[model samples]
Target: MRQPREKIFITCAVTGNLTKPEQTPYLPITPQQIADASLEAADAGAAIVHIHVRDPHTGNPSMELDYYRDAVEQIRGKNRDLILNLTTGPGGRFVPSHDNPRIAGPGTTLIAPERRVEHIAALKPDICTLDLNTMNSGGEVVINTPQNIRRMAKIIRESGVKPEIELFDSGDIALMHALLDDGTLQGPVLCSLVTGVRYGFQPSPETVIYARNLLPPNTEFTAIGVGRASFTMVAHSYLAGGHVRVGLEDAVYLSRGQLAKSNAAMVEKAKRIVEDLGGQIATPLETRDIIGLPQPAR
Candidate 1:
């Protein structure tokens, strides 16, 4: 592990697309609940809130523009300075039909690339995620071909929203380089090293360092681990000269045999990890500067 950076920023992923409420009752489903979770995370020292909307009725992920709008508006209602990172990663699931290999199966969620990033244009958050790789996510394939990637990057760029590239494994670094060469992705953007998903790289300090070494010089990385690896990787991330992310989206458990009560718990737990390591936790405004963004508009 390398020397820890001066300022460690925490991004709390309040809710993710895959997690269901039945699995964890605290998972925020409604717009109000999502905003409340973001606030709780912010209060717990998360400089940014990585957000994904869900269907309030079913507690499943949804790309409804109104849901995004409501969640963004409510978060900004009190704290405009807290950076909002909306997810553009939905609408890419592809499950091939068994009967016919060419046709999509019932679980397929492929949509026009334009539809995927439509909310970034509407809400204009400080940052939005652009998944760089097309990989097997769970049993289904998450499709983000080169063409679709370039298109989404174009839309996200035009809106002045910073694109945080998510990498599940080492090969995604190649895709990131390709996007950089084609001018689809801009410099100094964020990269999230997402480890510990099914078939993805297992979460560990060595894995974090491997991915960190592959990132471009201009890219800043946030190391996120799923499930049990979540908190452990926080220490690894900091020691490896990277940032950290936590919340119910990455892991529902606060510790062994214990489920996290809220997003705030994850944030607070990770904050302790950062501070205990002789590092300073960046405030939201400080985090904006760390990531090369202007202060919130008065």
Candidate 2:
């Protein structure tokens, strides 16, 4: 008997937590810009829009509730069907002062676990990220203790939002298991393997396979590779029966040296790759079903 092929869930991370306008001119900042990019990505075959808000004035990463509210409202106004997945991954960066190790620098943004997930609980997004491990994010430390994750997960679950467990390294899988055991996270689980971040898992075929093995039984997962490995990792993930995520948030380049003009451009390229590899892209409704999100009331 032949089995039907699995559909691919295409998630577009419209903007990230780290990249600034100085790094790439195309990064979306204002609520309008983020909404426009998200709509464009949805139109180009993205099933889910993974979002992170930036300061409207400075274009820096922001955990402000108003920023998230504005971005979500604007995006829903334009495209009611696009699934919104807000990031609760911010407010956990710890950067020590160069001059004195004990002195925290301005870069540190650590907050209470409940406080970090407050926006998601208030806004009630369909999905939100719960980064599962503490790692050296670039030069700064990204601290996600087991207690923090459990606390945040409980809040997310109570809000009726699915938690997209984000694993930066293989060891984080064990942390996820703990969440499942403690009843903080529910199944069937959805995980995203993040690669190419400094001091995290490197993007490679072997790494993807190893990470997949560590996931809970019958869990749905995706892989995203930052910088130059974006496209390559997408191809690898697709071939391995996992989904793929891409956008300016992960990589600004369409190729080795060419910069992507918009989030839609990245989605278009990802669609071509998925089609060429004999996979079908999941529609917005299918993605909602897979991730346990209700249809938009709008």
Candidate 3:
């Protein structure tokens, strides 16, 4: 078994593609709101902020490059050292039509693989998520085939930005090994084991152990629990020799029946949980070192 780290890093997913504005009043929508929320999370001890842009008026997910540029610039202007992890996960969902199973429905956002990582190549954030799952998601199906993964991976590699592989199931981890073996993905790898989704990896101690065992050598992973399992998995992940993540993206509640007022609120609670367990929260600078990223110039 891998030993638990002396210092753990916390990632705050400020906003996500699936979270609608109607769900929570505090969900960051516009670029300015995203930037502000991310800065707050950083202040509250989040070493990295995972971001997804949205339409300013409707609060729907958007793949516009300008939206990304504005939010990234705002965050970088204030905190040069904070790590920004942009999402390349939006354009992969497909909703089938009732009339024809083969035809894409209204909610389908499937686009060219090159378009998904367009922001990554333009902005060149510290890290970007590369999802490797082709799974059922509610009524829609998220398709990320090996061919598309390789195409997107090529762009991420060319941009000089690290890809934080998002694994939803054990099979995804298996695919990760294949990617590594084929030299499509370079290591030492940084990945997140996402649990608690209904059709994805189940949230439990056994799940964490099983998944961690499947990871390759020199891998750094964060065990992220969605919905109600968010805080519970913090303890589970830390004890299982992994990092932790929490925010509005993963959950909206601070506790049972209580809506979190901001992303920073979630990060503060996650930091407290790790600290109470005698695990230190790594700073952005320290995280850069731990994750093998180059130090920021003074």
All candidates' TM-scores? 0.98, 0.95, 0.99
What residue runs in model 2 are displaced by over 4 Å at the alpha carbon? Answer: 1-5
Ranked by lDDT, the better of candidates 2 and 3 is 3
The true-versus-predicted C-alpha distance at residue 69 of model 1, in Å, is 0.3
Model 3 alpha-carbon drift over 4 Å, by segment: none
Candidate 1 lDDT, tens digit per residue, 62-102?
99999999999999999998999999999999999999868
TM-score, predicted candidate 3 vs. hidden true structure: 0.99
Candidate 1 residue spans exceeding 4 A from truth: none
Q: Kindly provide the TM-score of model 1 when superposed on the true structure, using C-alpha atoms.
A: 0.98
Best by TM-score: 3
Task: Supply the global lDDT for candidate 3.
Answer: 0.95
Error of 2 at 251 (Å): 0.5
Evaluate all candidate structures by whole-model CA lDDT and list the values in order. Answer: 0.90, 0.87, 0.95
Residue-wise C-alpha lDDT for candidate 3, range 1-298, written one tens digit per residue: 6877999999999999887888899999999999999999999999999999999988999999999999999999999899999999999999999999899999999999999999999999999999999999997899999999999999999999999999999999999999999999999999999999879999999999999999998899999999999999999999999999999999999999999999999999999999999899999999999888888778
Candidate number with the higher lDDT (1 or 3): 3
Give the TM-score ranking, best first.
Answer: 3, 1, 2
